[model samples]
Target: MILVTGATGQLGTAVLDNLLQHTPAQQVAALVRDEAKAATWQAQGVSIRVGHYGDPASLDRAMQGIEKVLLISGGGEDDALQQHYHVIDAAKKAGVRCLAYTSRALKDPSSLANHLMVRHFQTEEYLQASGLPHIIFRNILYMDTLPLFTGPTVLETGISLPGGQGRVAYALRSEMGEAIAKVLLAGTCDNRIYHFTGAEAYSFTDVAAALTELSGRQVAYTDVENEVLAGRMRERGVPEVAIERTIGFMTDIKHGQEDIVSSDLATALGRQPASLVEGVKLLYKL
Candidate 1:
């Protein structure tokens, strides 16, 4: 069986949906924290396993006879590391033959935002030492944080923190999930570490232009310093920890740290990924 952790989430759901196209629904299982949230998946004939990163016992039960598990990185609190360890331990005990983990693109373990990737490395270590075949996909940044992105509440404030023109090889989260689904069902590619990325490169300036075209407005890019940006967010009531990390990572990327593009994602899936133009049309309903 193939098990997808965090199946109720956006990333996990994309994987589940794509996997259904490549494999039978009955052969798949959605490992979600809330069974109630998965009524549609259950009604569609896919097995629903109630589980959470915080609950090792539930993960154990969910992985009873599973051969492959996709450990989606859990988001929240200082305990994310501990909760991930619990899930990894359970997967080991269950004797799953293969495991795939969603991780960020961190070439340097000593980089500023490498803390998150470090945890993924820890999970990779557990999988390696446990004699379980594994695949670690160090993914590039998501394109969802584009210039046109806006929630109902945030749209009123207009665009914020429009950085001073830096290029990021931002891969679509859907493409990442599709690649994961492809690997899971292929039943090969064991003990392989892959770098998932998009085909083309783009800058925030390009993103702003696209947003102006899509939204048909006079939106423009605005650059600000790290400290001033953080202060503004703090004054607006954003959480301190989140604000700090957000600025840190953006600063890391802005200075040409995240400018490279790779073909690993295309090579793994045997096809090209969506370009920024394509991604925006789909995401922005344009």
Candidate 2:
């Protein structure tokens, strides 16, 4: 059986949906923290296994009879490392034949200031040493985050961020999930490390232009200082931790950590990945 952890999350749901198209429901299982949230997958004939990353016993139960496992990276900047460690140990104990992990594609994942990147780097290293044959999908920055950066009032406020000329190969979360599903269904791949990203890279300026055209409004890209953006977020009552993380993302982009273009996604899906403008149209309801 192929078990996918975090099956209820946005990307996870997409992966499961795509996986169902290629494989029978009887061969698929979903590991979720909340059984209530897994109702949809359950309705679709997917066996739902209740488990938490923090609980080894639950993961053990979930991994029963599972040959291949896809470990979705858990959230949070601090406890995620430990959570991933727990999952890895449980997968190893379960005698899983293959393991796959969702990670970020960066030139230097370890050297990044982003807390999430650091945790991912640590988790990748842990997985490497676990002695299990593994595949690493180094996903690029999600196009979904573009909406978050532009905000809901972008048509009125324009695109305001600390991101300057840095370009990002922003693949849609759904498409990335599809690519991952393809990889899983293939049984195995020749390459261990897959850099899943959009076919084209776009700067924030390019994103702004696309938004303007899609929205039929004069949306401008305003590159502000990190401190200025932080102050604005603070005034809006955003938490300090969140503000710091968001700013760190902008800093990473500005430094070109996310400015990557890879055909891994297209190669996996056997089709052209959506461009930033097309992603914006769907996300922004344009």
For candidate 2, list the clashing residue pairs, or say none: none
lDDT measured at residue 84 in model 2 versus the true structure, 0 to 100 = 94
Residue-wise C-alpha lDDT for candidate 1, range 210-242, written one tens digit per residue: 666776765555566778777777887988887
Top-TM-score candidate index: 2
What's the distance in Å from true for residue 278, model 2?
0.8
* Best-performing candidate as measured by lDDT: 2
lDDT of 2 by residue, 1-286 (tens): 8899988888899999999999989899999988999887788888899988988899999999999999999987467799999988998999998889999988777567676678887888999998988999999999998888888899998988998888899999999999999999998834399999999879899998998999889989989999999999999999999998999899889888997788889999899999888999999999
Q: Residue 204 error for model 1, in Å?
A: 1.3
Which residue window of length 10 is worst by lDDT in model 1? 147-156
Clash number for each model: 0, 0
Give the runs in model 2 whose Cα sits over 4 Å from its true position. 189-191
Q: How high is the CA lDDT of each candidate model?
A: 0.76, 0.89
For residue 242, model 1's alpha carbon misses the true position, in angstroms, by 2.1
